[model samples]
Target: MHRAKLASFAFPDRPAGDAMSVIAPQAAVPRPVSRVLVVSGDAALTEQIVRGLNATAQRLDNPHGLVALAVAQVDQALARVGSDGELQVVLIDDGAADLAGSGPAADLAVQLAALRPELSLYRLLPADAGGSSGRRAFDGVAGEAIAGWFDRGEVDPVGWFRILAAEVAEKAATPFYDRLKAYVALAKDSWHTPGHAGGDAYLGSPWVADFHDFVGEELLRADLSVSVPMLDSLLHPGGVIAQAQQLAARAFGARRTYFVTNGSSTSNKVICQTLLAPGDTLLLDRNCHKSVHHAVILSGARPVYLDSSVQPHLGLFGPVPQVRLLQAIEAHPQARALILTSCTYDGLRYDLAPIVAAAHARGIKVVVDEAWYAHARFHPELRPTALECGADYVTQSTHKVLSAFSQAAMIHVNDPDFDAHLFRENFNMHASTSPQYALIASLDVARRQAVMEGWRLLDRSLRFAAELREQIDATGAFRVLTLDELLADEVRGDGIRLDPTKLTIDIGASGWNADELARVLLERHNIQIEKATHRTLTLLVTMGTTRSKVSRLMDAMQRLAREARSRAPASRPVPRRLPELPHFNRLACLPRDAFYEAGERLPLLDDSGQPNAALIDRVCCDQIVPYPPGIPVLVPGQVIDVAALTYLVRLLRTQQATDLHGLADVDGERQLRVLRREEAAPGLAPAV
Candidate 1:
């Protein structure tokens, strides 16, 4: 019998000036225990395997030892697997040769496979088990579900322990990140495009040396170019980049995954262009991000807008009514695609499974912009993500909630007939030719981190959010908006769910408007919130949110409440209310044509400082979107109406810290871009 020896864990040495050497001086962090669950009614066999694993850890001088837990009942095992995020492996003891011929044991195996596909499953065979018969049984019973089988008669217990450790380590590997780090350790001479030349340019000059010191040397050194063949090219990825994307696809439950260095904005455009062509009809959410409107214009798609419910008092917009969406789908049977944003900026998610099914039945592709819900798939409580709910294409801003750097995003494809060649052509059109290597590497590491520790991190975040909500409500001055409050009456029975991590607090009774509270929190307390509306403030409790951060925010709120109460009562001015969001208006022409046509900027207000009513009936040549929730009020080609103009005027008059895009400030007046009189005429046919 050949015996395998455990290798000592050590990093390779790098040269003195190497980037690795500069950053490698650090203390050794302790590793967490590798936990394995054993399913068997036989106590004696379980004990033997557990002891062997512990003894092997001791002999190898492993910092963190191995621990095996045995659960006899199937229900107990399932509970442990679901609750314990640290579990790495599962060993099922099939006493008889027939692993599948049983009651609870077989059922346990099936449940584990479905619940945790990341787990490494190994079957424990009897001592006398041998030959092709045992192998055949294992394969036939679970197929690829069972990773491998261990025969007690053939191998010693140490070998079994080693195999389990190896599996855990494999899950923790960051392919692109590890390779990038290794290449940096080489300290090779650089004649790269980046004039910094591995930061030597900055370091060599006395004037810029301070800047280099401030930014750190490792970042510039790791910023290598495609000239270095080892780091691989983002545009034509066949190496570690491909492997990383494959891992991400599996982790995110998609057929294929593509890394986006540019943000979900670009991802939205790429998907839209790939799916739609000139004159194609699309059903789009009226409250979608500005990027979706840009996509509609760029793709030359004629959009049939679906109206979203608006909370006028709260200054918020919710998801489209289920009845309205279904009606739109039925009305537009020739529509090529349906696009919507799940989990709106304030965290209201649609019941997407039925919606996806409805779209698919009509041969319409469904694209879900899940830019804020990237962390949804990691926890069971957040299941049924857009992709899991059968979306054809889903775009996620990984950097928004995950550990990835800014501008890092991902596009997941789950279409049955996904055109790889056509999709790649469109993706390359939006993708930068010279991509940032560090951003790509971050995407790789982000996937590994999410796969390994996401459940544990999200569990902590959910708990913190819950505690904060209760404590904040106890203040009485401010109340956290519950699921019932966030959902509109129209979407009550539509099976919509609000993400608990998003805490929207109504600050009406706090004696301060949302803008005032946000400013005070930032200026006095040095705390910045996610979004603020007229009467409500939205705070995102993500995986990165800590207990200390939550406590500080609560303390600030309590102090502000007390201060407001102590002050003498004054004549409180009535806060200005935002106008109701306008419904989808009839387009005078196609969005693409109106956008590309000759246009002139018209002042929103006339000389008397009143709204220029002349601009009301004119066709808009640009999108008028209010930032924070970057939803467009007037998309290109849409004819301006009283309701839409009122919304814009109120927003400008209030000056409520909301950014107005596509509307410009010219010669001390807010201007709206509109098409010429001839071009704005109605009944224009689609350009051939």
Candidate 2:
């Protein structure tokens, strides 16, 4: 059993306050050191070594500066170094062995030589020198002793300098396209990205014949491998892939840009992992997409949730108030960053500048989930993007509103001081091992489309939204929630944010439930609104909508509302509070842990007191989640919350609900797998 311990010292000890420190000049070392390559697994350690090298340069009275590139993974570092170079001091982090269990230090040394021929490499003993908080189980060496290895000619200085110089030279001269091409070849299209592989017509469904004809064959041909000639390599590259990424960086006003193939879900995780560690605290908006919450779990970081203002009448979450973020950071002074969603799903936009300024006041980084606001950068009227608001990391999902295919996204680092290397490392770790070439090509073209015609396209879209809103109001049967109603004094506190792009039609006063209205519309007219709830039916509009489509939607909504009002009013219990999303405090076991942990299957009522880890067994396979809002009623690692239970029971009672095939039937079946009571007795090992 892993027993949790109280916090004694969050950080390791440093040199005792330097109370009696003395400055001494060290002996001069050998010359001809033009470059230095510091190879380490830990980025923080690499930073310390760079600082140390600057000190070393000053002490040696050397005029030439050392250029360093620190990569977390050894494979990546080796790939970065060129064949023509000689290395001065190749410093490997002691923790690097855990990166992948290859072998002992001797084996590691040999592998290093194989990667770069005739290189002088030296391993630094992790002691107080690097200031690592974790246990250092390697050779016992002190800070002065580690520094001695560098200053006292313990390694071949001339060879080390040659290797580092060669690596640096290669990095400087390598073209981005070449790297991209290599990555394309290395990437084999699996069942992963680009659900369509090379646009092979044979594999496509007959129903997609028209789509295939509409989108040309050239588009598919260009969807070649990311490993193709001179493409930017995912692991390491210097070619067109690099050029494309660089172009994106320039277009987005970012220092660097990373193409994300796994959509905003992965993008969220990458941002969290790159900027924060286990001990760091993050301020999160309560209405954040489930992705941010998942990232927090993966990163092992605690979060201070800033509840966004919700519109009770509208039945939607709003953007977080700027003041709440300030209060949160002020309360948790040590918070490293704040994450917020720019424009919510309902199309309500939040001004991000004030929030950014507040977070930056205390040197805290701001990350914006601009997934829904992908068109914001293109449209001047939209809320300021993460770049415009001066956020450190901005994540955009191209597929949400843009023409790019699904699972397509990008992460931009806006700050100069932001760690590009760390971002790449974390991104590479969580991202797909084998990326789809189609997505890379799509992202390349998507950036061009967004930049060239985004503003013009969005302007048309805004006009269409306005026209639709007007028509919905014209229909006396249903009232469209307008700007006045949303901003009214009485509704201001109840309603937090409003996005004009969405057509949120209120069916509450029309004597019909939102669900009934939605069903009637779909059945009567061949038109469908998004999911409906008890109060409202939301309609989403993007670049895909035309004036004709809007007219038809208004016609259908008007007819449905009229038909609903003609019927007798049905009496039902009014829910006072909106459904609360589930929260998890601890993981009884990892996904793999729960897979292997022993437990028993029992009825749902009998298993209430027993600990349970949600798994993918047939009984638990069907995720009994609310449909309109797809928040999981019971997540994989959480003890089912009270809301979840009530929601499940209510969902079963509400036969009109479309989703929940499994849980709705759970009432009849007395079955659930949980920890056995006797096995979970005090002082005994828990069964789960």
Best by lDDT: 1
Clashes of 1: 0
In candidate 2, where is summed lDDT lowest over 10 consecutive residues? 679-688
lDDT of 2 at 396: 89
Q: TM-score, each model?
A: 0.90, 0.59
Error of 1 at 427 (Å): 1.2
lDDT (10s digit) by residue, model 1, range 193-285: 777888888865779877876766778889787788887777878998888888899889899999999999999999999989988999988
Candidate 1 residue pairs in backbone clash: none
Q: How many residue pairs clash in each candidate?
A: 0, 40
Instruction: Give me the runs in candidate 1 sitting further than 4 Å from their true place.
Output: 1-28, 60-66, 94-103, 113-117, 123-146, 149-156, 204-207, 571-574, 680-688
Cα displacement (angstroms), candidate 2, residue 292, comes to 1.7
